[model samples]
Target chain A: MTPQTDRRLQPRRFLLLTLFLAGALLFGLVAGHEWASPARLARAFANSGGHDMTSQLLVVWRLPRVLAAAMVGALLGVGGAIFQGVFRNPLAEPYLLGASGGAAIGATIALLVPLGLPGGPVLAALSFLGAWGATWLVLGAAGLQGRPDTAGLLLAGVAVAAMLGAVRSFLMLALSDDTVNLQVVLSWTLGGVQTPDAGGLAILALLTAGALAVSLPLARGLDLLGLGDDQAFAFGLDPARFERRAVLVGAAVVAAAVAFGGLVAFVGLIAPHIGRWLIGPRHRALLPASALIGAALVAVCDGVARAALPPAEIPLGLVTALIGGPFFLILLMRRLRA
Target chain B: MIAVDCASVSVGRKGTSLLRDISFRLNGAGFVGVLGPNGAGKSTLLRVLAGLRAPDAGEARWNGLATPRWPARKRAAFCGYLPQQFAPAWDYEAGDIIALGAGRASAGDASPGHVLARFGLTALARRRWSMLSGGERARVMLAATLATSPALVLADEPGASLDVRHKLDLLRRLRSASTSSLVVAVMHDLDLALRFCDRILLLEEGALVADCSPDDLLAGDALDRVFGLRLQKVRRHDDHDWVIGLG
Candidate 1:
């Protein structure tokens, strides 16, 4: 639908914008290399029988990073939308609920002690478990009275996150002398989407899909919940039950994203808001729009991370925050005017 | 016709009673105005009647069924409640908000367009709630409540922030709506309540002080005692009764 005639396709516009964004990022990724040129790309595609060094680098290096970035971004974007809708607070995100903190602490401890398993997968597993533990603890604290307490859950998340932060600090100081262990911990926690192998990519894909499956069905409930618990109840919804389900879905998404790309921030928070601003607050359109926007944001950040500095890669989280922060300000200003 | 029976219901919280041993039986169609001083359990009584809150003692029943026994979805179909302090978090269109209430009603509820037209809110159907004036917002909310075509409507402070014209219009619509449904509203304006309500329930410190017609209530000293004021009659016409408060 054309923008002149229809607003129903407002979200479609945002999705199309994301596609264009992805195309630009792919162009940058393929052509940004000093040795790589249009002639090389054309030759690589034209000559199918013999493999060249350029084609090998394209397949082995660039493709994995792009796919991981898109997957992780979709997870974060969807998770952020669920969290904000469930909490009925625009500032709410997966990280705000302590999932990332728990994952970071778990990954740190796993790195310090050799788990006798393959390093990446073991760390990912522990991180996932840590995030799950945090979610349960938060829900338990909120459910002390048999009924789920929204305010209590938020408070509990803050306390748990602070405690986990302290524990992580203590561990870092304890291993200050061992530069190798410290470097591993810092690299894992400080944010970067490492190029994953085929198996790792498959696991990430499964986890993200599972999170989406849980979240999409509850979109209507989330809209009701946004009106507040009492209003939602009056409208024939079980607010506490919906809140529990939404939180679990958000936590699962956060866990999966953190395991793959350590502590990437703002993609979850910014993407949903952008989606809402582009479209309305309806979750049906908001969910997919946010997911696409998130995927594009992260994919572009990864492209810049790799290609901007030649061989010296910038951290994914830094790139996102630096750009997302200014973008958020502009959105806020526009909202105030409207 | 629906029958509401509050069998000695009492609600207390934090060692303070909000409603104490209140009993009432209402049947068929009429407009009921619940009047009370500040913190006199007007909203609490509505909540208890709507089945959102359970009383500490006794029970609220609709027909022969206990309020708590009715499934929420079913209860929502026949019972429309407009809370005292409600502000929608999202800035939805007026028509959309009405549709949300329409969905809470039983299937084949009145269309949002029809309800909005009845409430004189058709012009503002496309306007977002955030852009509406306070009076317009109140009207939109009332439209939403009425769109459900509920058998029983419990509205708290439906005319809280409206001008005199809107307030009178709201009471008139509520009065007419009672021809097909039981309408109970909590009001602070005594004159409006007296002029519009078919019956009045006066509450004082969580106790039912008086339950009668407006004429009977005006003739008694109970209102003076309950309201802590000396109410004086200024004038009375065949269609209107004017009372002035000499505090």
Candidate 2:
């Protein structure tokens, strides 16, 4: 809001973010089970049917994985921004608020219990339910409807997530003993980008687009919500009704992101904060910035995870946690100091 | 055009009431000051009348329609509320906050620049809210409150943090605004309310104790008893009165 920040910050922000994302994309395309040159990667990306082994490897596996990472990251980032904006709480994110846990539970159910539905819709629907349920439980427990309490919400989120984690574990165990396979549990727990499938990647992309389409219009109303509930009502928005719609959108986005790649932690948390700190705090700028920055963040993390060890690979969630935990701590310290 | 009929607001069903069967009606533009001590349900009344809160018992009516039943957007277009406490969770420039009043939601035509200039605050538009002084921030918010040029302006303690000069300036502006719009404000300053307000609603213990002209309030026993202080008119001038309170 300073005069120093006016007119100069926005374009520069997009420029820097674009450069950052390009670098991450190149790094993502290049570093994998086998190293491909950036040029070869680009060629493979442009021409999907590359006959050579390295080109095929880049085209088939690496490209979809990287794009999926970017898509999931964008969803999480925008989801986090929406929650933070509507709730007016800096710490509001899917992972911290237990929405991810809810989605995990729903996804595990879809994997274990055969509803005869296809993998995509079942996963999306149940995960959406889980996410929305967990978010509402947190809000109700934290008493967010009546007052602003960061500490209360944080505690409530922790408690609900812990409870949901227990449920997820029990379901996973029962499924492992009965008929369901164990690999899905491992991937969901480790939270990594699996070998990419083109159709799944396409679905992730579409869902990301749909969530963003719904969220963009909610910006001005969310801005009015930053004013107190009574004041928001005076300004023609019912705070409770508007919050339900926004929370539903945010939960849906987070559920879709998690369904793609288990539970990628802190892309949501880190991307939105960076956008808010570096750029202005308006939702219009922050939402897109958060998505782009989040895409870049996850792409870089996946690149680092694969490239860090030669034959042995680190989990994407662990790397993100290693980076995001410290970042969250620093943010917490700053907020406490303020 | 604005009225509350036997309206009541309470905490829980069969719980302690915040407002106890308050009833009044206003037909035209006037500056009505709601004067009370702390926790006298002054803000609660303002919220009900502004259509922000529906009463548990009766109704807050605008042009005869019940507020809670009215479509929310329509009510917003009619009533403008200025809260006693405005906590902005984000960092925004003064102009940005003012612009919120006119765009996207309400079909208000009075632009932010015009409202800012009306308060003689065109300079503070671009400044960070953190950089502005308390008085300057309050004025900016006041401009935002009036940006829509709402028919009924319900302000809760609009000048609670202002100095003498700023308080007088704010009151004068509100007085002028009242020529076209009904302006109701919760006031703590008895002298200013007496000098500037056309009518006064005296509230005490979750009840409307008196509804009368400001001069009648100054001459009445309710003012002395409700506020738990001796309030007197020391000297009278044509334009204003020299009133003081001794507690």
lDDT per residue (tens digit) for residues B1-247 in model 1? 7998889999999999999999999889899999999999999998899887889999999886998888877787778787776766566667777767766756764777678887788898877767798778777777777777788989887777778887787777788989999999998998888888888999999999999999999999888898999998766657678778999
Model 1, A1-338: lDDT tens per residue?
21121246674687676776677456544633343565665566566422877776666666677788888888889988987787665655566567788888878877776668788777767777777788667656655332334456567877888888788889888756776878767766667788889988898888777777778887877777766666677777777677777776677678778878887877888888877766667687778777877877888787777667776777877888788767656654664465
**What TM-score does chain A of each model score against the native chain A?**
0.81, 0.93
lDDT for each of the candidates? 0.77, 0.80
Please name the candidate that would achieve the greatest lDDT relative to the true structure: 2
Q: Largest TM-score belongs to which candidate?
A: 2
Provide the lDDT at B49 for model 1. Answer: 91
Worst 10 residues of 2 chain A by lDDT: A1-10
**iRMSD (Å) of candidate 2?**
1.6
DockQ values of all predictions: 0.46, 0.70
Candidate 1 TM-score on chain B: 0.94
Best by DockQ: 2
Report, for all candidates in order, the number of backbone clashes: 0, 0
